[model samples]
Target chain A: MRSGSPVYRRGAALALLVVVLIALPSVVPAFFINFVMTQTLMLGLAAATIVFLAKYGGMVSLAQFLLFGVAGFMYGNAALEAGSRGLNLGWHPWAAVAFALAVTTAAAFLLGALASRTTGLYYLMLTLVYAVIGYFVFAQITEISGPSGITSIKRPELLAAPVSLYYTALGLSVLAYLGFRALGRTAFGLALQGMRDDPVRMASLGFNVPLHRTLAFTLGGFVAGLGGLVNVWWNGQIDPASIGIGPTLILLIIAVIGGVSYFEGAWLGAFVYVAMSTYLRDLPLIDRIGITEARFNTVIGAIVLLIMVLSPQGLAGIADRLRRRPTRPRRPAAGSADETEAAIRRAQLIDE
Target chain B: MTATRRRLPVLAAAAVAAAAAVWVLFLATDTPAGTVLDEPGAFVVTALDAVTFAGLLFVAASGFTLIFGLMRTVNMAHGSLFLLAAYVAVGVQQAMVGKTRNIDASEVGIADWLVPMLAGATAAAVVGTVIQQVFLQWNEGQELRQALITLAITVVLADQMLREFGGLAQRMVWPGAVTHFITIFGQRYATTRLFMLGVAVVIGVLLWLWLNRTRLGMVVRAGVDDRQMVRGLGINIRLVFAVVFFAGAFLAGVGGVLGASFAGAAPGTDGAWLLNSLVVVIIGGLGSIKGAAAGSLLYGTVVAFSPAYLPSQYSFYAIILTFGLLALVLAVRPYGLYGRPA
Candidate 1:
């Protein structure tokens, strides 16, 4: 019944998905498990980053995928540079993540600052533009990155098993979510939310609105950077098709369907998306229905429309509301927590 | 009126776009490839290709800018809508000819007479309006919610399409006598392409007049600057939005139809076209027709010419160039090429 604080309930649900995901590689056949679990985790990371943008920053940047794409390329490039004898920059795969994260962070910092000035749909437009360019960069750059792609890409060292890679992705995603959670509670986080809902008032209060947004930009980048690395790691390669605008926007869809407002949204979106895409891939619905896979995008499109119409709050928001009513009377630690703890939790609710 | 007097920013944007175009041409000319870079004739051909590319891109982006600039709704479904319309238009072309759509530009001369190009565009508008009426009306000013809702719609539609249509890429074919190439500047090009370029320009001019000299355009501009204020002036904001949505969607459809005549509509066209439109609108200015035109041309030229000079392996160099340009423009001018300060 989720009979406790909404936080407890949410934690419980995420924990449940996590446990299921952890068990997947072993519990299910390796073939199906790897694809599903990896995709879910990657999207979960993407969606979590989006939550930071939506919940704290009041931004609707469509270009989260730009970070995702860049991060993937960074990973691929880092690997290639490390692996190539002529251009050796030897670092363990784990260490190479630093290179990728740094690039992603810098790009996010630069782009986010630009995007931070824009609100609502304008931000979305800028983000989309960034994504397109990122896609092109992914598709074109021969020496730097491109369509020919960075192949023969090996997985990171110290993560030997598919399960291990999945777990590292899972662990990092959790860490990122926690990082966002911690950040969302800081003086800066509060100031950013204040700006999100009311920038002029926050400015009147001398919060330096753009500064908080810039910090938020950095944080969002850091999280998305993690996603990019893991995404390439998951796919085991990089190419124009993988990194271009199409896949980038698709990642946005994954984040949105999962509910961009909270960390849970990412995992949820990943789950739904992976399940649906997997179903589409394995099933011969196109054959049975007499339509080609090229046209299968309608299924994704129609579902998105229905979700928009029927559940604007998304599955997570709806779950929270339901969790609030009828089942909240049973918490054991009611009123025992300090006021600051409650405030932090309340803020988490809004952001999440 | 006085903001219009502040013409420096607009001029600056023009300068930036011009500089980018020159940079691309310079690099393309310097490349070592024979067919790609050996001839002065090749650069001219490529530049023309860039112009056509920008023209088509402008058609895709104008409606997007209008919808976003005026109302702060980021319609993620916009791309899907364009893709859907293109798919529908291609279907129409195939039906009229009673054949599979090979969509070779070689076969397009007879198409003008068979189905007025306007029809496909009109169908897009109808679909756009219907989508707005049914899906978008209630979600008017809530950006994130709107984004999510539309995203859901996109996913569902994508799946439905895959189920209905096989994965094979389809094209809109032009039949018989119309399929011949029109040689311009001593290089062969599709006449349909020339027609498309003309159509895009004419439409741009007409749309400009509609917004500037016409009463409707004035209202739309006013609406963009301040929707609540426009309503106070006795305009039905809802109806205007519906119309804008229709026009925007219709343009996408027209682009889809003509686009099939060139690149062919495939499973992934929505994302590709959407990304290009986003770039055009962003570099230019959201919701500004002039901005979209400038941005489209900027992006179009990059698309046409980058492959000639950039290491073929690094072909997506244009994207980096775009981001670099966008970063520079946004850093210096946040409102895009022609967007007024908010």
Candidate 2:
């Protein structure tokens, strides 16, 4: 797979992408670079958690936001000022974050243990039930979640500035993406992919389907937790509303819109979702149509419907198709050459 | 182990009740609050209210589970449909009340209530038909895709309802004759609730008879059991599916009207109802009328009694316990009490 100029081309492309992102703040408006990109990257991380499980584990869990919300609440309660909306642990930032991660991991594992026994719609419902329950549980506990929300979360010293925080999100997301890519190449990852395609066959091949799925779910939860931690830091607040059905659906929409099958799709989906949400109302077309801020859901819903019907693979899928289009013409000759090589090797082995 | 597994839900339910009993006992002695147990007369009243509320919740959840059982598609927008129906019912009721100026303002006649109920049911059924035909039919068997599509539909519908109806909460004013309070077990309770309970029972019985005896109901059950086989038998499966969808949606509309008659309808009610029905369906076996009934009773009892017994500060414990019950049920009987494992 790495035998030619394509590897170098890919490396150069990656380098250029990184350079553009780093230089984006200076080139573009601060609002677009900071508000848009920073928020979008954090959201993308959350969506990436969904995409990871959907792509590799074939489990479409609706509880990703639950993990995000749990971690966010933990951070908010521990790190935010005491006597505010929620519990005031007033722990150090690192200590609070460590606690958040631990709680999130345990919650994810427990949820996974319950959910992994089922498949398809049952699994969907199980996770959805968890999400709904999680929302209510968190919302109702006024002492922990507060009546309004936990607010006034101070960012850490090193990543307080919007630009620096953006960089941190980008760097963390890049690391996560690389980690996922590496994971996907390992034996366990290969087994997961195989299980996703045909779980019965994988099981027949001596794989522990439920355990693998649970592990994948745990990893997905961690990814989502990280996203939540960053998101809480970015927003400087955590609310029950942030973890409810609306946000969960938004995350799902973004993941599906960007292309649930690809890692890069999460970023693309988050970009589109953030852009549409933040900028769609100001569009001239909407203004001409007299679309108010209240009616934005109609537009978003219509977009979701259209995208689901016309291009279920989302924007990433479209990009993938475009990229593959140029290479399609040479596919037959390359396939024939490989076929001949395989035939010659087989014949030589038979003769021997 | 298998026998224990089968009995786990019942056991868990019993355990929950016992725990609740113990908590109420503690509250009665330890807590200095206005709990129902403190005033003995309130217990019966609370139980009655819970039963009535559960009756309405059951109507909505039965429809939800029916559609799912037959089609394997969760109607994510069932709550929106419920809310829409409530708005329609209220709209019709207001129109009638406006026309009847000669009559007393508080006294709503039978026509006012009946016509609105029919209107709401029809509107919801029509919407369900359109949804099934326009979007869902094409994506048959793609549960996730269909669910997403329905979610979008719900969002659109919910927004439209908000735009049209505004954000105000409106309750249906029942006929004045039936709205009065009556003594039940030495406690005064709204007669309208008793009427609602009776209506729910009648509807439940009718639904059962229709499913077991009527030709269409039999087809629906058959379709639920095996859609492909029914299709192979030369039955017009599409028509059956559309009909089932309409019936399910129609039930939701009926429940909405009933709900709004007392509880009132508002912007967030759709989400609340959707979650309520989903929880009920989860607790009761999905797709079973009996299961829906059982779930509603338990849910209604918990919701009703919690607010009555718990302190105002800890009222949200009801929601927590409801889902906790759900978790317990899932651990015991994953497919629900009556639901077959697919």
Checking candidate 2 for backbone clashes, the offending pairs are: none
- Positional deviation of residue B54's Cα in model 1 after best superposition, in angstroms: 2.6
Error of 1 at A129 (Å): 2.4
List lDDT for all candidates, in order: 0.68, 0.80
For model 2, residues B1-342, the per-residue Cα lDDT tens digits are 266655776787789778778776555443323444565566678778889989998998998998998987788889999999999988888888885223342668878888999899889988987998999987787776777788888888888998999998888877776777777656777788988887788889988999999999999988888899999999998898898899999999999999898788998788888888887887787777788998899889878876667766667676776766676777766667776553
**How does each model score on TM-score?**
0.80, 0.90
Query: Worst lDDT window (10 residues) for model 1 chain B?
Result: B29-38
lDDT of 1 at A24: 70
Give lDDT: candidate 2, residue A325: 82
Q: What is the DockQ of candidate 1?
A: 0.37
Per-residue lDDT of model 1, residues A1-352, tens digit only: 3366767866896688778867777778876767777777777887777777767776666667778767777776766654422123445677668888898889888877776656655666677677666666556555555466666667766665777767877788778877788787888888877677666566667776656777787777777778777778777776666655556656777665655565677788888878877777567555676544555556666665665576654566567657666654321110111222233324324422
Winner by TM-score = 2
Residue B167 shift from truth in candidate 1, angstroms: 4.0
Q: Which lDDT tens digits does candidate 2 get at residues A85-144?
A: 677888889888998998999899988876664555566667877887788888788888
At residue A198, give the lDDT of candidate 1. 62
CAPRI class assigned to model 2: acceptable
Q: Each candidate's root-mean-square deviation in Å?
A: 7.3, 7.3
